[model samples]
Target: MTDTSRQFVLGKRPDGKPDRDTFELEKGDVPEPRHGEVLVRTCYLSVDPYMRGRMRDRDSYADPWDVGDRMGGHVVGEVVESEHDAWSVGEFVFGEGFWSEHSLLDGDDLTPVDPSLQNLSLPAYLGVLGMPGRTAYFGTLDVLEPDPGDTVAISGAAGAVGSTVGQIASLAGARVVGFAGSDEKVDYLEDDLGFDAGINYKTTENYRAALADAAPNGIDAYFDNVGGPISDAVFSQLNVDARVAICGQIALYNDEGVPTGPRKLPQLIAPRARVEGFLVGDYATRFEHANDRLREWVTNGDIEHRESIVEGFENAPDAFLGLFEGDNIGKQVVKVAEPSE
Candidate 1:
């Protein structure tokens, strides 16, 4: 076993968009596992849009990480050493671990990875079958619950959550329209994911007009991943009894202060629309059931997922910063190390 573990620490608080200097790579000796704990060698580290919100020193659903603190998120790793009877060496598991080559975690918090599923790639545990997939599943299926023939509109349509939302929405027989940042992503949505319409929001000057053209039936359901102007446009098209799933506000994640935009509530009041914000952790107790359904969808080709993988542990920061720059077409993950043999 290797004696050293490399880790990334938060070197500085970001002013607006995070940069390379925001993280510091440091190496330390891998700690011996204590009783009831296990040592894991990380294979895949997840980079999510929500991590941007946690970078700032502010009150939010997740706690803020201070400077010099270890950056942590979803990781899939192999147990290298286990002091707990419940876990064993060579078993792959998933848990919230720091950005490091190795992690020591309590056995109670981790769930074992299925070796059969890992045959495709360990990265899947950090993306599709993991948190982002569940977020997309619950937000679209549970929150909005679009009916067959319902016109459903989504923002951030090429993203991990948005892409999954589009696919699942299509399966539910909704007329899916997605708004993406680039023409390539728009094509991926409309041509590859089977979305009914895909709008390039970055190039489109009139969001309301684009939405009107796409959903002439009016939007019966909305899956919002990017907020601000796109949301404003979507609100104006909500059909009566419209439902909205507020997933992420990535458009406002890097704002220096609260951003001002046109009021959208007025559009909702008359339509009796519903909007709700949710975190994937809120469905913890039911994760097993959710994972089962998602796995079945994936195995049966009902849910198609993608990952823009960064090659090394050292590039984790670059992968994270790339989220704001729209560098990835799907879920982003950093390969920290190869799995234990």
Candidate 2:
């Protein structure tokens, strides 16, 4: 192991969309684990849309990162040093880790990774079988609850969470319509993922018109990931007693101040639709169950997934910035290092 470790810290909070200047890379001595902690060498680091929220000085579901604080997120790594009874050197684990070559984590906070799991790579735990998967699971099964024959619409449908939600809803017998940024992604959703129809929002001038053509029965369930105009269009086409799962608002995440759009409440009133925003942490107790099911689906070919990986720990910030630009097809992850044999 190297004596020096590199990490990215918050250089400054952004006024609007963050750039390379927002991250400060620093090299320091590798940290040692105390009792009940393990030192992990990161293999894969997750870059997600929600991390943008942490850049702000204001409070939200997660605590804001102060200037100079290390940036952290879901990481898949292998233990290199251990001071904990449950973790041993060379074992793979997943947990919250900073954007660094190595990090110290409480053994209790880590989940052991089974490298031999069928049809899955280590990065899968950071995407489809990780937090994004759990978010799609609960948000679809509990919040959106699409019924058989229901027409379900998803915004940002080609992304990590939204993609998973579309598949699960299909498994539940719903006809799925997906809205993505490009025709290529739209094709991926329809041709590869079995979405009934796909609308490339970038090319389409009228969202409601495209939606009407795709979901002629009107939308019975909606899994919203990218809010804004797409959401406004989805609201206008809601069927009676529709359900909307308010997941992430990626479209408005980088806005400088409060963002205003068409009012959607009045549309919901006539439909008597139920809309609920949820955090995956709320279903923490059920994660193991969700992971097991997600694994089974992936293994059995019921669910298909993809990863857009940016190699190197140094590119972690760029991987994150790419999320807003729709540079990834599914999950965006940074490959830091390979697990040592």
Candidate 3:
């Protein structure tokens, strides 16, 4: 057993895009679990776009991380010590905990991982068969509700959730168009992911014109992941009775101040479109159902997934900072420590 754990803590709030100084790495004593608690050794740590919202000192969907406190997110870890009878050593579990080598977790906060549940690697539980996949499942099928032959467009389409949304929509028999940051990502969406078309938002000079050309019949379903000019283009291409699922706004996540963009409500009015912002946690009761489906989809070649992993717990901060830079193609996670055999 180790007494020291390396962790990152909030150092200062960012004015724009965050950097290494935004976090401070420190070594602290490993927390000892009391009654009804267990000590976990982290194997992976997820760094997501939503984490940026928590960095702010304002009221939002999630609480802000206090300065000097241990930064935490979705952590997949192994039970190394247990003070609770319900948990045993060497068991794999997922929970919200600090970005450290080890953490003390309450039994209620932990979800046991069934190694035989899916054929994907253990780390797959942190991505495709995990939160991002589940978000895509509900956002595309449940919220957007695209139909056969309909054109479905996704902003931030190369990203974790957006990629999954596109694949799911394609599976539902819709023509999928994706707006990504790079030509390489555009190729990934079209060539590798089976999307009908992909637009490189970064390289395109006339986004609206490009989108209009791609979906001449108009977009029947829109999954908004990057809310900015790219989103505006998608809004302009909406068809009658279109459903728009607001999954994320990563485009404006690192803005220095409140971003003022073109108002798009007028675009939706005549089209009679429905727009809703959704959180994956809202469907918590049905997570198992979603994961099971995602597992089957990935395992059977019906769906494909990718990950941008930053090796070592030491570089976790850099991995998190890279999200705003669009450095990753899919789900971004940090490999902290290898799980025990």
Candidate 4:
């Protein structure tokens, strides 16, 4: 095993969108696992839009990262050494791990990756079979609750959570309409993921007109991942009793102060729309059940998943910044290392 390890720390908190200067990569001795802890060699690191919110000094659902603190997120790794009975060397595990070549995690906090499910790649645990997938499953089925023939619309539709939510809503028999940032992503949503219609919000001059053409019946359910003008457009065209699941709001995540937009409450009143914001952590106790369903759908080819991987641990920060630029098609992850055989 290597005697040295490298990790990234928060160098500065940005007033707006963060850049590479916000991260500091430092080298140090590999940390040793203490009693009841396990040492893991990180193979894949997740880069998510929600991480942007965590960078702020203000409090949110997730704790804010203090300046100079090591960055951490969901990681898939191979256990290199273990002082905990539940884990053994060579086993793969998933847990909250640091942005480093290696991390020391409490065994109780880690979930063992099943070797029998080799049909799916290990990175799947960081995406479809993991947090994003479960978030989509619960948010679409439980929150949005689209009925058959419902016209469901999603913003930021090409992203990890947004893409998965679209597919799940489609499976529930909803005519899914997606709003994405680019033409390519719009094609991906309609042609590849089977979305009923897609609107390129960046290229389209009028979202209301686009929605009128795409979802002429008006929107029955809205899975909102981006909160901004796009959401404002969706809100303006809600059908009666429309269900809106407020997930991530990446559009305003980097703003310096209170972000303002069109008044939407009055519109909601006319539709009697139900809008509820949720964190996937709210359904922690039911994760196993959700995972089983997601796994079945994925393995049976009922659902298709993709990953946009940036090679090397050093580029983890770049992968994260790319989220804001809409650089990834599906899940954005960093390939840190090859797991030992």
- lDDT per residue for candidate 1 within 1-341, as digits (tens), equals 87999999999999988899999999999999999999999999999988888889888999999999999889999999999999988899998998999999999999888778887768888877888889988998889998899999999889888999988889989999999989999989887888999999989999999999988989999999989999999998899999999988988998989998888888889999998888888988889998998888888888777888999999999999899888888788998887756
- lDDT measured at residue 59 in model 1 versus the true structure, 0 to 100: 89
TM-score of every candidate: 0.97, 0.98, 0.96, 0.98
Model 3 agreement with the true structure over 114-166: per-residue lDDT tens digits: 77752356667788877888999998888988889999999989888889999
The digit string of per-residue lDDT tens for model 4 on 173-278 reads: 9999999999999989988999999999988999899999999999999999989988898999999999999998888888888777788999999899999999
Ranking by TM-score: 2, 4, 1, 3
Arrange candidates by lDDT, descending. 2, 4, 1, 3
In Å, residue 139's CA in model 4 sits off its true spot by 0.7
Model 2 segments beyond 4 Å from truth? Answer: none
Q: Give lDDT per model, in order.
A: 0.90, 0.93, 0.87, 0.92
Mark the 10 consecutive residues where model 4 has the least summed lDDT: 112-121
Worst 10 residues of 1 by lDDT: 119-128
* lDDT score, candidate 4, position 67: 93
lDDT of 1: 0.90
Q: Please identify model 3 stretches exceeding 4 Å from their true place.
A: 117-119
TM-score of 3: 0.96
Q: How many collisions per candidate? A: 0, 0, 0, 0
TM-score (C-alpha) between model 4 and the true structure: 0.98
Candidate with more favorable, higher lDDT: 2 or 4: 2
